[model samples]
Target: MAHLYRRRKQYWIVYYLNGNRVQESLRTDNERIAKDKKKKLEYELALGDLHQSSKLPLPMILEAFCKYMLRIRTAKSYKNEVSRLGYFLARSVTLSSLCRQGADEQRTMLHL
Candidate 1:
C-alpha cells in the first residue's frame, strides 16, 4: 500500500515493496494529485512492473544476449548480430549517437 504524507509544501510517499522500503517525493502539494499518483503506484506495484533501477549499457546487454544465444542454439543471423554489436562496441561510441541519428531521420521525414 502507498502511504501519502505531507512534508511542508511537497507531498511524500512511502511503501514497503519486496522487503524494501521505497520513499519518493510526489513533488506536489495538492492532495488530489498526490492521491492519484499514490493510486497509480499501488496499482503498478500490484502488477509487479514498477522497475526502479538503471538500465545496463547496450554493449553489455548485447554481449549477454550473444552469450545466451550461444548457449541455446547457433544461427547465421545471430552470429552476424554478435559481430555487428562487437564492431560497434570496439568503436567506443556512446549509444546517444544512434538515438540522434534516428531523430535526424525522423526530422527529415517530417520535412518531406
Candidate 2:
C-alpha cells in the first residue's frame, strides 16, 4: 500500500518496493491527484518496473560530459569548451557541490 502526506509545503507520495520505502513529490495541493499518484507508484513498484537511473546523479553526469568533451573538443579550444561546460554543470545541484573542491580534487574524486 502507498500513502500521501504533506511536508515543508509540498505533497509527497510514499510507497514500498521490495520492502524499501520510496517517496516522490506530487508538487500539487490537490489531495485527490496526490492519492491517485501514490496508488500508481505503489502499483508500479509491485510490478518491479521502476527506472531509477531516469534520475541520474549530477557528478556521474558531469564525468560523462567531461569524457564527451574530451572526445569532441580539440586542445586549442578546450578551455573555451570547458568554460561553457562549467556553466552547464553549475545548474545541477550535485555537480555544483563537486565544483567546490577545486578542479584537481574534482578530477581525482571522479576518477574514484
What C-alpha lDDT do the candidate models reach, one value each? 0.68, 0.64
- Candidate 2, residue 104: Cα displacement in angstroms equals 9.1
Counting only residues 3 or more apart in sequence or on different chains, how many pairs clash (N, Cα, C under 3 Å) in candidate 2?
A: 0
lDDT of 2 at 30: 81
lDDT of 2 at 14: 76
| lDDT tens digits by residue: candidate 1, 3-78 | 9999999999999877888899999999999999999999999999897654587656554565565456545554
Q: Best candidate per TM-score, number?
A: 2
Clashing pairs in 2: none
lDDT score for residue 63 of model 2: 62
| lDDT of model 1 at position 28 | 95
